[model samples]
Target: MKRTVDVSFPVGPVHPCWKEPARVKCETRGEYVLRAEVELGYMKKGIERIMKGRPWQEVMFLAERVCGICSVVHNMVFIETMEKISGIAPAERAAYLRVVANELDRIQSHLLANFSYCYTIEHETLGMYLLDLREKVMDLLEKLTGARVNKAYMVPGGVRFDIGEETRHAILGSIPRIREETKRYRGMFSGGPMIGLRSKGVGILSREDAGRCHAVGPTARASGIAVDCRQRHPTYMKLGFSPVVRDEGDNFARVMVRFDEAIQSLSLVQQCLERLPEGPVLAGGICRAGETVHRGEAPRGELSYFVKTDEYGRIAEISIQTPSIMNIEAAAHYMMTGAVSLADVTSIFISADPCIACTER
Candidate 1:
């Protein structure tokens, strides 16, 4: 007679599976996951408190520190909220450039996320390949922003600088190769035999459950929810945008959604560069006392910020709700549902692309 091994333990605060410090308590009967719970707050930085009483101009760098991975969206959302409160409009060229910077960040982020997923599934070769490809996107970002990560590029009314002729020519030359690499990776993720076998029908989050959990970004999109703030943003609308959605609501679906979005983002970058408008990038205006809200579709999902200004136009209150919060919470609950195996729990958790830095911020 064969014996069954019952297991129940925690997988973090220090674990090989996750990059950050988080605690995931997992209970299992034999090899099947019976329950799981995620404990956060190991990485909180009290950034909202720091933003209080600061000028809107100074908060841009603070917001960028919220998460190294989703820094661009955080800064953009903050700037947009401030612009709304102060009634300042960025120039058309600035808006398009903002989209370009954002999409480049999106491409790199999605690639890193997919690589993480592949690593969790023990696909080392694929992970290395993705990282190599991701380097190209990062190089482009470095050229545009002068910093590979956490670029303090956006100012109150517009970006801090403009792309020079040399950088512009380089971007134009690299688009086709980048697009080709993105398409190749997309094909590998969508139909690759190892990924399909390990991810297909695994960690299924049904459409109804997804709605109830308030999922966002590619997580919700993979579950067939079509909500992308980019499609609604005026600048992105002008550039022509659409959400990538899949109905499978499984790990494979989640990975495929990101793959498809990366391909789309490459096209968006091409559009922004080709149609690069000519004009000033900054609108330069004074801030007025007001309250406002703004949203941006980050690589992981919807990132939103609420801003309140004092009589002098200084920040009175600023609160942020990153996509990782809802996505991580909901995924913790989904981990125990259905027939998820104990071995696959980490992969499933990472599929949601939970950024603890952003979540606990």
Candidate 2:
């Protein structure tokens, strides 16, 4: 006779598998998970509250600190929203430069994300390879923006600086290697038998559930939802950007979608470099009293900012909706339920790419 018992398993506020501090409590019977719940609130920075009464200059830098991994999009969206309120439009050249810098940020972010997934699944060699490539992408960002993490490159009227000929040549030179290496690793991820056994058909988040939970970014796209915020952005429209999607809705699909998007992001960088326009990088403008909501696609998904400015152009109220908030809930409710293997529990949660830094903020 065999005996079966249900047990509570917690992976969590501190773990070797994920970089951030958050807990996942799984109810399991034998080797299969019955349900799982995520516990957060460990890393709330109260950044929005701190931003109140601060001028746009201070708020801009504060916004970039919301998430270290996807900081550029935060800076861009906040600045663009301020520009809108002030009736200022960035210079044409500055707009394209913004796109280039943003796409570079996206590439590094996606690579780091995939690297995290690989590491979680115990594929350390592949993870190391991806991390190394990410460093190269970070180097490119440093060359363009003068800072690696919080670039602070975007301004009200335009960008802080223009790219030099040497910088342009270096960016162009680096793309092929990154692209080729990514392609090879993507193939290994897709075709490797052990990887398939661990990833394929595991942690499935169906299209219906994905929509219901309002999943965003690669997590949503992997479930066959083509909901990339970039498609609606004016600059991306000019670049003819399209979202990459897959129907699997599994761990493998989520990771592969990121790989594909990283490759696509590299192509975007190249296009920006070749079609690099010539004009002033900055146009002067001042933040004025107004209210507006702005949305931009972060590496994880759609990030939204709602702002209300006072008469003095200082922040009166601000609210942020980070993609991780939605995705993490979806993972705990939908993706982590059913007969999930205990071994696969963490990988599935990670596939949703929950960023506590963004969520707790």
Candidate 3:
């Protein structure tokens, strides 16, 4: 007996190609998607609940653990919040280093995301090429911060170490190669037919909707929202950075914006390196503290941290909201582009730079 109607697709909380655990249900009429439903495999880990009893200073790493890609941003958020609460700012030199590290972190994130974008678009060679470039940045991070994945370089008052001339020179050496490779790959991106076919006009989120939805980072910029935290936010003000906003609001636009932001981050790092001031890195800021909240730009979008302290730096309560969490709305919205194929959905997922670890922890 044949059924009059149809319903069923094998998708996953686990699938070979998909990195995160999520189930995708699609109503398909042959290869074309008719409808799609995404169910996150697990509830968010609820790490925010863990922050309540930790000391303000220690909570820095806790927040960083929320996502491997955005760990640096989380570290910054916690520190900035602590600074506000305690009424102590890092020395000028420290702030400069924070900017440098933050920029590098953002670069690493975009590199990884773009490579994954290529993977979903069936460009493994380009994906590997970009991944190779990203490795250099990761190596640079390991050298500077001593841990490749989490980095753990951010501490309460400021960054744990400064990038001195010798280290800076080494990092500077890698940039030219990075630029060359990026140029070559971007050439492929523009000329590749597959990338053109899969991404060009897909998942178009209009400019107004992007702003109305309050998207962040490349998403908002791709949609022409112009809400880059760097332009108006206080922490990034002195670092002197501007976002790479695009008006297309398509998959290609989102992908391109990530690449552009990576370049901008590199330029900002150069500026921060040149303008490095002279002073102690910590400024005796953490040992004495109170409580406060800070919201700043992360590679994904706006990151916020709230800290409460008593007489000692020990925290009474700590709460954080990484961009990826709020980023859910944008994903749901863009998904309306249709039953975005597993491939297209995955590509878009990478572009958003989700940090499950960051979001979870």
Please, what is the whole-model Cα lDDT of each candidate in the order they appear?
0.86, 0.90, 0.72
| lDDT (10s digit) by residue, model 1, range 35-102 | 77787779988999999999876788899999998788888999888888888999888998899899
> Which candidate, 1 or 3, would have the higher TM-score against the true structure?
1
Higher-ranked by TM-score: 1 or 2: 2
Ranking by TM-score: 2, 1, 3
Which parts of model 2 have CA positions greater than 4 angstroms off? Answer: 1-5
Model 2 C-alpha lDDT per residue in residues 148-208, reported as the tens digit of each score? 8988999889999999989999999999999999999999899889989989888899999
Go through the candidates in order and give the C-alpha RMSD of each one to the true structure: 3.3, 2.9, 3.3
Best by TM-score: 2
lDDT of 2 at 207: 90
Quick one: how many clashes does candidate 3 have? Answer: 6
Best by lDDT: 2
* Order by lDDT, highest first: 2, 1, 3
Clash number for candidate 2: 0
